[model samples]
Target: MIATVVSSYPKIPNRPSPARLRNAINRFDRGAITEEEIRRIEDEVTEEALQQQAEAGLDLVTDGQIRWEDEQTYLARQLNGISLNGLTRWFDTNMYYRQPVIEGAITWQKPITVDDYRFAVEHSEKPVKAVLTGPYTLARLSVDQHYGSVGALAKAYAGALNREAKALQEAGATLIQFNEPAILQHKREFEQFAGLCRSLVDGITVETSLYLYFGDAEGIYPQILDLPFQLIGLDFVMGAKNEALLQSAPFTKKLGLGIIDARNTKLESVDEIAERIRSLAAGLASDQIHVSPSAGLEFLPREVAQEKLRRLAQGVRQAEAVLV
Candidate 1:
């Protein structure tokens, strides 16, 4: 079994702290700091995140998205016809992301996340997974002034995402993941969203995954299982309905079992996590299961996040032993 994070790791411990980085970004915008200095800070943080994941012994790792301002705004800013308008609360978190304003037709101007993925690959011994915000989530989160409707915006976003996914694949990314936390709110448009996800990965040869969190997935479980993704991640911690959903639905794809709660500060025992995985493993192949925090580790403190990762790795090992 593989142990990994869904997306986003905590920021580097110190030296180029969040405050310092924010100041650097502000300085760069005001022409007080050079672009090279900003790049240096980003590289330092990215390397620290990668090293932390490596030290924790994860089977698959992510770039930790250190350079990202927020999940959607960073990628949205790279596309044409979208502007960062103002601050908006991100989901239920204390943090905020600049709201993406869709002013006109959306088009991919350049590779958004490929360079970061490549950087992580070069710095780490572990294989890196290229992570992107899904088309559905991007469309749902952005203010749609030009697209007229969510469906049209999603379609446009999918095409742009396809270009980015292909770029990551070419950059030696064997695994690609699209984060669509907004899908939980748009359950009625399941079919349309599924098709959009398919469009995003049309010609990509690498393994693809769709990670849904922050809400219940039980209502759309059976339908979501049919999506073209090779893996489906469900937040069992937040979505208590997922337990019944998993039991009732036919889960043919690999399961990213979210047993650790990323939002909560209290540490979960490795034995408890292992038991949850063991129970889920009874219904699926041992190799088909992957363990992760219920969502991104960004909600926790840096030291807490690192300990959670260690527990995740230990829990997977214990669960796999039972399965064997």
Candidate 2:
């Protein structure tokens, strides 16, 4: 079994915080700080985030999305015909995301995250997985003035995502993940959601995965298993019923078991986590399981997040040892 993060990792200690970064951006915008200084800060933060993932003994690493303002706005602003509109509470979290405004036909004019993905690949010792927000989530979070309906908007965004995924694949990314947390909110559109995701990955050759978090997936179980993804990630921490759902469904693809809680500050017991992994492995097989936090580790403090990563890696290792 391998360990990896779904997306953003918490900022490291004593480093320039997100608030500081935003302030720097504000200064740069107002011509108080030079563009070169902002780039230098971004590079430094990304390098540290990569180093922390590698140090955690993770098999797959990400840039920790340190450069992103939030999940939606960063990528939304990068695409053509889309702009950052206003703030909205992201799900039930205290954090806010800049709601995307669709002013015209959405198109992928240029690579948004390819440069960042390449930077992570260049800095990290381990293999890096390129992460992107899924089309459904992007469409759902956006204020669609151009596209008539949510389905139409999602499909348009799917094409853009497909183009981006292929670009990342050509840039030497073997693993690509599309995070669709919004799917849990719209369970009635399971078939349409699956079709949109299929269109997003249509002809991409790289290994692909889907990560759903922040909500229970009990209602959409079995149906989601039918999606064409090499791996499927589920939040077992937030959705305790997922264990039974997995038993009831026939899951053949790789399973990214989110056993660690990322939102809470309380630490998880390595032994208990390992035991749960052992139980899941009894039916799913240890080789098909990949362990990670239930969601991004950005909510917790730096030290606590680091400890969680260590515990996650240790717990997975211990579980695999028991299976061996």
Candidate 3:
């Protein structure tokens, strides 16, 4: 069994203390510091994020996305022909992201997250996973003036993202996960989304996962199993509809159970998590599962996020003990 994060980790400074990273950003905006200085601060926070996950006994780690802005903007600001505009509320949450505006053809001009992922692999004792905000979510969140339709824009984004995914695969990453929470809301677009997903996942030998969070996926349960990803991550933390899948038959592919809440600061019940995994014993083998939060920990305080990691690692261990 493995303990992993679905996508991001928190970088918020602890309360009552000034954060060097935030301060650096302020200075950077004022032209008081260089981009390298800003990156140095990001590196510190990324190392801290990876170190805490290791200390909590997690087998898989991410860069905590310290160097980037929000998940949506991180890729949009980089890809060709897309510009970032005003902040908009993300999904039903209070959180906001710089809305990506599609003004022209979207293309991947260069490497996006390779340097950060490489740094994570070098610093952590455990294997590192590279995460990308999937094309469907990006298309839904964007202001589409050029593509005329979300499906067309998503397909273009997928073509670009496929190149980026190949870059990560060649960079020695152990896992590459695409976050596609938009599917939970736009369930009617499953066919369009599925075709794009199949093309994006083609030819990647390393482990790949489609991480869906922020809502339930009951509408497309068994049908989603046909997609090509080696693993499917479900958001049991967000909706009861997802947890209901535990009563279904065994999963053919590997699974990721996002039972731990990332939005709430309260630490989870270890016993409850153990039971959740136990419930999945019928549907999945213990080794075929990855335990994680419903989404990124960027919604919580830094300390709370680390504690959640500890809490999750503990729960996974307990589940393993009883499952044996």
Candidate 2 to truth, TM:
0.95
Q: Which residue pairs clash within candidate 2? A: none
User: Residues 113-190, candidate 2, lDDT per residue (tens digit)?
Assistant: 999999999988988899999999999999999999999999999999999999998898899999999999889998
Q: RMSD of model 3, in Å?
A: 1.2
Model 1: lDDT of residue 140: 87
**How many residue pairs clash (N, CA or C atoms closer than 3 angstroms) in each of the candidate models, in the order given?**
0, 0, 0
What tens digits encode model 3's per-residue C-alpha lDDT throughout 1-324? 889998777776686866878888999999999989888888988998888889988989888888778888989998998988999999988799999999999989999998888999999898899999999999999999899999999998899889989999999876899999998899999988999998887778888899999888777887788888988898887866866665664577888888898899888888888888888655467899999998998888888888888889989999999887
Best by TM-score: 3
Cα deviation at 265, candidate 1, in Å, is 0.8
Write candidate 1's Cα lDDT for 1-324 as tens digits.
999999998865544445556677889999998999999888878888888998987888898999988898889999999988889888888988888999999999889888888789899888788889999999988999999999999999999999999998888888899899999987999989988988999999889998999987967878888888899998988888888887786789999898899998899888888888888767788888878999888889888889889888998999898788
* Higher-ranked by TM-score: 1 or 3: 3
Q: For each candidate in the order shown, give its overall lDDT on alpha carbons.
A: 0.88, 0.88, 0.87
